[model samples]
Target: MASKNLENFLALMAKVKGMDPTSDASLDIMQDYVTPDMEFVQPPSFPHGGVHGGRDGWRHMAKTLNENWQLHISPDHMWDIPEEDVVVLYVNMEWTAQKTGRTVHYPTMELLRFKDGRIARAEIFPQDTHAVLETLNAHD
Candidate 1:
């Protein structure tokens, strides 16, 4: 059986898949699963990189990325650490540049922390930042 937190996390991911990242509907979905003070951390080298605070901040990050790339994250494995209120996911991320139609595939590890059944923080670590950057800059 999955922990309640992990279950909620999975539910949240399901709701957001293929949804418009900048839409009000997406924000509405996030409200149900995320803490008001939810923090999202991404690599500073990436275009959408930064520490985003709160649900609104999360929306901003999502919107920023959505503007440039179509992203698909497929979870390869997941571990629920109930004692720590954490769920760790190993995922394959595919990013397609909207402008160039170039695609990059890479692995990433994500840590999601829960508070009162809602996600309070999410941190992403990508395996090949350079490859992703190259894809982002591709001309053809």
Candidate 2:
């Protein structure tokens, strides 16, 4: 059985992916997974170019990324670091432009944390940032 945190994390991830193209994102779908003072950060490789501090901070970054490109993050694998309240996941992330049909595909590591059954924090470290960059520039 999945732990409460694990369940929340999975639900949150799914909800987030489902909304990227249409809505700001159903990120608050798993608000229960977050603390009143949650902090989420990312590495520079992400489309939004990384950010720091709080749930709203992450939301702003996500919105910024939506402006930069359409994000499609599909999971390839996941490893649970139970003791640390972390889930290290391998994912295939693609960025595509609707107008140009230009696309970038690559792999990345996502370090996710859960607190009180909510996704309290997360970060992404891309494995092939070059591929993503190349994709972004291909049509230009």
Candidate 3:
């Protein structure tokens, strides 16, 4: 059986997968599954890279990423570490540059920590950060 934390994580991902990143609805969805003190980490190579603290910071990062690229993420696998209250998710992601129409396809491994059944920390590790940066910097 899947842990409650993993189920909540999957539910959250499903809610946000196709939603507008900057929309109020998206924020509401985030609030449902994430703690107010949530921390999100992205690769420095990304335009919106860095460690984002709190829900507001996460909102900023999501909005910035959406503005720069159209992202499609499909979860490939997920494992729950019940002892540590963490869920590890592997996803296949495709980012299409809005300006240049270039696309970068990569896999990402994410570590999510839960607090009171809500996501409190998330760290993303992309398989090919260089390719992602190249696609983002590409011109038509």
Give the poorly placed runs of model 2, Cα more than 4 Å off.
14-17, 45-47, 98-100, 138-140
lDDT of 2 by residue, 1-140 (tens): 55666666777676676566324446556445577566666557655675556766767776766766777778889887667777888988887864455887888888888776666677778777666656656443
TM-score of each: 0.89, 0.78, 0.90
In model 1, residue pairs whose N, Cα or C atoms come closer than 3 Å (at least 3 residues apart or on different chains), thus clashing, are none
Worst 10 residues of 2 by lDDT: 21-30
Candidate 3, 1-140: lDDT as tens digits = 98889888878877888875446687787788888999999997788999999988999988888888877878899999978999998989998888878898988999999998899999999998887777767554
Cα lDDT over the full model 1: 0.86
lDDT of 1 at 69: 83
What value does the lDDT take at residue 99 in candidate 2? Answer: 45
Between prediction 1 and prediction 3, the one with superior TM-score is 3
Point to the candidate with the largest TM-score.
Answer: 3
Model 3 worst lDDT run, 10 consecutive residues: 131-140
Report lDDT (CA) for all predictions.
0.86, 0.69, 0.86
